[model samples]
Target chain A: MSKVRFGVIVFPGSNCDRDCYYVLKDLLQVKVDYIWHQEEKPKGFDCLILPGGFSYGDYLRCGAIARFSPVMEFVQDFAEQGGLVLGICNGFQILLECGLLPGAMLRNQGLKFVCQFIYVRVDNNQIPFTGAAQPGQVLQLPVKHNEGNYYVEEETLKEMKRRGQIVLRYSTKEGVVTREANPNGALDNIAGICNERKNVFGLMPHPENSSEPILGSQDGLLIFKSMLQYMEDGEFRYGGGEEFRYEEGREDDLDA
Target chain B: MKRVLVYVTPKKGILDPAGQATQRALQSLGYHEVEEVKIGKYIQLTIQDNNFSESSIKEMCSRLLANPVIEDYHYEVSDV
Candidate 1:
């Protein structure tokens, strides 16, 4: 099969850009390139990665300032055209800030920066991002962040649950969902979610950090493989995803 | 010159961990009577343009100064 081409975005303060590049190019042997935040071109890539880190030094909110980067416009356009987008940690924040994904992140419920290996249950395996895993599989991943507490209104939560938008949830290694297993008090234990269209995914855990066996887990590699598999299937092409408007998404209605 | 004061606060239903932590600290320091402490951002912008409008400032707050999803913002414009 042909290799999957991936583009990893690099905002000014994104420290994980190189890590993502290493995983895709060295580990997976896939064709990958770095797209600086100022550049608008995201041409001819099967997938895009918004790697984790303090974009804009987490100023004015973790992902707020970086969301306005020129490259995001193209990324937004790409996703609407049925391209796959994966956002990790700070990348998730930027996606939320840019309205590529729904909900907002708040400070960790304990008000401390949390850095540790945690297990997350894959709530849905039917979607492209988690398709390589079993429906209730638990994967070990590391999360390092200060603002990883995901918050969404109760009604939106219900709607997302119905659409299978809620894909990952913090859980015990045994795959039990409980408050004690939640590392960051995210509402509904949400560690990750996808847009209703299933093309854009954002997760707080750093899959790039734990993609190799030496990193103590190879489970992270499954996520990348899923993207590769989805691309190879060649199903979701130019016209499969739902219509997406560039204006702030579901969050706008919440202000009312 | 004109000054714009913008206040961005967590929305009514959103949890404010920072504010809650501060409140705990204050209460521990014997300010037990303090019922609540809500944290927010106070921004001061000095406009050199005479045409600076309140509507524009409001838009600024809505667009960048505050995230409408989990926060609310209000601004005041006055002569500096």
Candidate 2:
């Protein structure tokens, strides 16, 4: 198969462009390109990533202005046709602003930016990006953001739950998913979620930061590996596949 | 013209620790009489033509300005 093509977006205030670029190119050994936000179009990339940073200085809310960038027009089109899209931290907020994701990310409940490594449990493994994860598996990833609180309506939340679209959940040391363990107190302890089609995923955690053991953890590497596997297989399953879904209200020991 | 005021607040079950901290700070500064504080956003918008409707403004808020999940919105529109 040809080298997996990855595109990392660079906005004016985006500080993580190089970080994401290095991870995809050096760590994953994939063909990676950094696309400027102002570019009229981004071509020849299999996947698009909106990396973390304070875009437009986080004015008018975290991602409000950045959502209007020219690249998003193409992103919107790309995602509509089953292209893979990942949004981390501020990028997650941009996805919400653009309606690519169903929920919105608000300011941290504490009103201060929180930066640290967290244990996130893989909740849905049927999606193209998360297929490498085994259900109930926990991985440590870095999260640095001021606005990462995820919110969705009750009906939608229930539907997402029933549909197995939730990809990751914040886990306590005991491996219990709860709001108290969430860095930003997101709804249902949700750290990440995919669209109904399972092609697009938005999460607050920075998987690129944890993709290497030298960076403190290699837990996030599986996310990239999973995406690569999806590309190779050319199969994208919705609802993370029915076989991977755990029985309701199940709990297990946490490795964290 | 029609003017609308939209108030956006965090829904219950969602932590508002920032609002709590602000309330504590206000009390420390001798604003002891204050009962509570819930920090939220207030947006005022004006639409062209007197025939503009409240549902239109509500739709705008839902699509462009507000996220209806953890945020509940209430708006009142009046002729200006």
Candidate 3:
């Protein structure tokens, strides 16, 4: 199998960019590059990862300002072309701001920054990012954010649930989904979700921070391994090969 | 110069943990009359253009001043 190239977007104040780059390039042994936010054009890569950090110092909201960066235009186009995009932590907020993902993030319900390891259950294993795990499998990942509480309208939540777009949920170590297990008080204990096309995914946890056993937990490595496996199996093409029908009414109509 | 005063707040149905926490803190300080507290952002933009119109300001608010999904914004324009 050819090397799966990955691109890690680096925005101003993105502290996790190096972590993601290190995991993908060194740990995962993949071809990875860093794409700065100021770059108007994105380099050709199989997958793009938006690493976490206080982009723009969390000005005017977590990702409101960073979403307008020049490179986001290319990222939007890339996702529209069915390119795989994964957003972690503040990156998740950017995805929400850019309309690449549904829902919004609010201040954590506890009114404080949460920085600790939490368990999340794999809600859907069929997606390209979670194919390495089984449904209901529990993975321990670290989350460090003050505004990680996810919110969505009731109707949209139902539609996402129906479409299996809810990819991960905060859960207990035993894989039991319970309210008490939710660290950030996200709606329905949702820790992560993907777009209708399932090509874009956003989650608040820092998967890269836990990708190595030296970090005390390598469970998060499964996500990166799953992406490589998907690419190796010829499930995704780096450049556009087959034109996919862009689903209508799936652009996260927030007004509803 | 024209002064644009923008106020951005979370939507009504959305949870505001900061506001809630502040409200609780206030209540603990003996301000029991506080019915509700919603925290938000106040931004002031000074525009040098005399031709600034309400539509243009509204466009600015919609585009950058606020996020329609989670926030709503209103603005007041005055000559300065």
**Chain A accuracy as TM-score for every candidate:** 0.91, 0.91, 0.91
**A1-256 in candidate 2: lDDT tens per residue?**
3477999999889987888888888887888898999886778989999998999998756788899898989999999999999888888888888888898776777787889988888888888778887767788898998887788878888788877788898987555776567898677778999888777898889888888889999888788788877886777533243565545654433322
Interface RMSD in angstroms for candidate 1: 0.7
What fraction of the reference interface contacts is present in each model, in order? 0.76, 0.47, 0.82
For every candidate, what is the interface RMSD in angstroms?
0.7, 2.5, 1.0
Segments in model 3 whose C-alpha atoms lie over 4 Å from true places: A236-256
Worst 10 residues of 3 chain A by lDDT: A237-246
Task: Provide chain B TM-scores across all predictions.
Answer: 0.91, 0.79, 0.92
State the C-alpha lDDT per candidate: 0.87, 0.81, 0.87
Q: What would the DockQ be for model 1?
A: 0.78
Query: In angstroms, how far off is B50's CA in candidate 2?
Result: 14
Most TM-score-accurate candidate = 1
Runs in model 2 with CA error above 4 Å?
Answer: A236-242, A246-256, B1-15, B28-33, B42-80
Total backbone collisions, model 1: 0
Record all residue pairs in model 3 with backbone atoms less than 3 Å apart, i.e. clashing.
none
Off by over 4 Å in 1: A236-256
Model 1: chain B TM-score relative to the native chain B: 0.91
